[model samples]
Structure formats: C-alpha cells, structure tokens
Target: MIAVLFRWDIKAGSEQLFKEGWSEIVHLNIEKHGALGSRLFKSKDGEWISYSKWISEDHFYNARKSLDNTEQARIKMAQAIIRAYDPIVMIPVIDHLMATETTHINQLS
Candidate 1:
C-alpha cells in the first residue's frame, strides 16, 4: 500500500470551507477512485494534515487523472483559502497493531 501526506496552511476564516471542501474531495477519491481511506488532522501549529491510503502509487495517480475536469475548479476554490500546500507520497515500511487491542476494539458492540 501507498500513503500520501498533505500539509495545508489555511487562510484565516476559511476553516469551515476548507473542511467541507476537503471532505468532498476525500469522498470522491474513495467512491470513484478506489482509494482505501483517508483522514484529516490539524497540528498545534495550525497546519491541516491529510493522510490517504491507496492500493499502490499507480492506483493513486490513475484515480487522480481520471477525476472530472470540474475537480480542478473545486481544488482551485479550496486552494484560494490556503497559504501553503505540501504533499508527499510514501511507502510504509512498518505498520503494527496489537491483536489484543484490536480484539477489544472489535468487541465494542
């Protein structure tokens, strides 16, 4: 699997708009592009971080290229409220989970 990390510095007063627009983009990537999943996080330093998983780098780029042309407009709208954008693609070397903890979590029903 491949993971992508994006760090965004949002402009003042555009937090809500950024959140809504980002959610929509993530939704489209999942539903239309076969992305595994994605998450958004905010740092104490005020940077918004996004983590997205895919089957492979090829899947990631393929999905991106297949997006509708309108996606550019949506991205531009979102970008208008950003101070900076940084992105990185990574290949995970290690991922660990404790089975007992996982079992405990699964038991929460």
Candidate 2:
C-alpha cells in the first residue's frame, strides 16, 4: 500500500472554501477512480493536511493524470491553497506481531 500526504497552509478566512474545494476534488478522485480512501485533518495551528491511500503507485499516478490535462496544472491546483505546500509519498512497513486486536477491542467499546 502507498500513502500520499498533502500538507497545506491555508490563508486566514479561507478555510471553508479550501475545504469545500478539496472535498470536491477528493470526491471526484474516489468516484472516477478506485482510490482506497482518503481523510482530511486539521492541526491545532490551523494547517490542513490530507492523506490518501492507494493500492499502488500506478493508481496514484493514473488518478492524478486523469484529474488534469497536464501535470503542471494539477500541481498548480494543489498549491493554490497555500503559499507553500509539500507532498510526500511513503510506503509503510507493517509489523503484524506488534499490532493490537482492534476488532475485539472495538466490540467491547
């Protein structure tokens, strides 16, 4: 699995619009392609971050291609929300032995 993290520092008073636009973009990605899923989060300091999980790097690249006519345009759109944005892709190394049983604990809760 691959995870893509997008960090945005939105301008003051533009949070709502930024979120609305980002939500639309996320919906379009999931609807048009088979993205695993995505989540949006906000920091205590007001920075917005988005994490999207994909089955493979190909899926991520393909979805991004389908979103805009050119790679530059897509990047420009992503950077529009903030003065500076950083995107990172990482592959996690999971250790099943150290993992907890979430299903059982959730049932009890």
Candidate 3:
C-alpha cells in the first residue's frame, strides 16, 4: 500500500475554514481521483495532518493531475488552507506488522 502524510500549518485564523473546506471540497476531489480513503487530524499545537491511502503511485498522480485543471476546485482548495510545506512525505509500506510492532514497543518503552 502507498500512504501519504500531508502536514499543514494553517494560517493563524483559518483553522476552522481549512477544516470545513477540506471536508466539503478536497475530500471529494480525493475520492474522485483514486483515494482509498483518508483521515484528517489536528495536533495539539493546531497543525493539520492528513493521512491518505492509495492503491498505487500512478493512481495518486492521476488524481492530482485531474485536480489541477479544476479551477473552482483549486479556488476552494486555496480558501481552505495555506500550505506550509511542499511535496508531503510519501511512505511505501513494506512490512506493516513489523512497523506496528516497532510502534507498540516504542510506546511501551
């Protein structure tokens, strides 16, 4: 499985707007493209994080391409949040159980 972690440091006053925009617009665009599904999270410090899963890199790329030509989509996306970073991290899962085990051990430790 391919996973993407997008971290956003939203503009100071735009947190709620960002979430609402994402829920209303971005989520649909993602689903339309090829997203398996995704979860949105907020840190204690107020940063936004999105974890998106895809079947393959090609699907992810295609979806992104589709989004680019969408002007209204881009406008909504822009209104939702300001990007703090470019090219969010993509992690290819190789051994899920091993990673889970390591996480559990780290939490215990």
Candidate 4:
C-alpha cells in the first residue's frame, strides 16, 4: 500500500472552513477515486497533517488529478490555506491494520 503524508499551514480564522472542506474532499476521494482512507491531525506547532492510504503510487497520483476540476470544497480548502507542503509519499514496509471500527460524523465527540 502507498501512504502519503500531507501538511498545510492554515490561515487564521479559517480553521472550521478548512476542516469542513477537507472532510468533504476526503469523502469524495474515498467514494470516487479508489482511495483507501485518510486521517487528519493537528500538530502542536499548528501544522495540519493528513495521512492517506492508496492502493498504489499510480493510484494516488491519479486520484489527485481527479481533484483538479476545482470542486467547491476544494476551492474552499485552498482559500483556507496559507501554504501547503509537498506530500511525502511512502511504501509501507510493515502494517497491521487491526481495527475497522469508525464512528459516524454525528457521533464525533
């Protein structure tokens, strides 16, 4: 599996906009582009990070290309970003995906 790590610096007061747009984008990618899934994290230093898994490097690249149509959520995400770092792509050497449990959006707490 291919794992890609992404980081972004968000503009002040745009956090909620970014989160909503990002969640939408991720959902779309998973539904339409054959992405495995992804998780979003906020670092202590304020960098927004996303770790996404894909079937392969080619699949990952292809999926990103599909996002180029300038979808509204994508535009919203871009507007909220101060800067986005180049993605760090990796091939997993050892992976143990032991859990499949997930909470629904409304169940977030």
Among the numbered candidates, top lDDT falls to: 4
Residue pairs that clash (backbone atoms under 3 angstroms), model 3: none
Q: Total clashing residue pairs per candidate? A: 0, 0, 0, 0
Global CA lDDT computed for model 4: 0.85
lDDT of 2 by residue, 1-109 (tens): 7889988787777665665666666766677666667777788987778888787888788886784434443444455576547678878787253433444642342
Model 2 ranges with Cα > 4 A deviation: 68-80, 95-109
List TM-score per model, in order.
Answer: 0.76, 0.69, 0.65, 0.86
Off by over 4 Å in 1: 69-80, 97-109
Ranking by lDDT: 4, 1, 2, 3
Worst 10-residue stretch by lDDT in candidate 1? 97-106
TM accuracy, model 1: 0.76
Candidate 3 differs from the real structure by a C-alpha RMSD in angstroms, to one decimal, of 7.1
Error of 4 at 74 (Å): 1.1
Question: Best candidate per TM-score, number?
Answer: 4
> Against the unseen true structure, what C-alpha lDDT does each candidate score?
0.73, 0.68, 0.65, 0.85
Off by over 4 Å in 4: 68-70, 100-109
* Pairs that collide, model 2: none
Q: Name the better of 1 and 3 by lDDT.
A: 1
Worst 10 residues of 2 by lDDT: 100-109
| Model 2 score (lDDT) | 0.68
lDDT (C-alpha) at residue 64 in model 1: 64
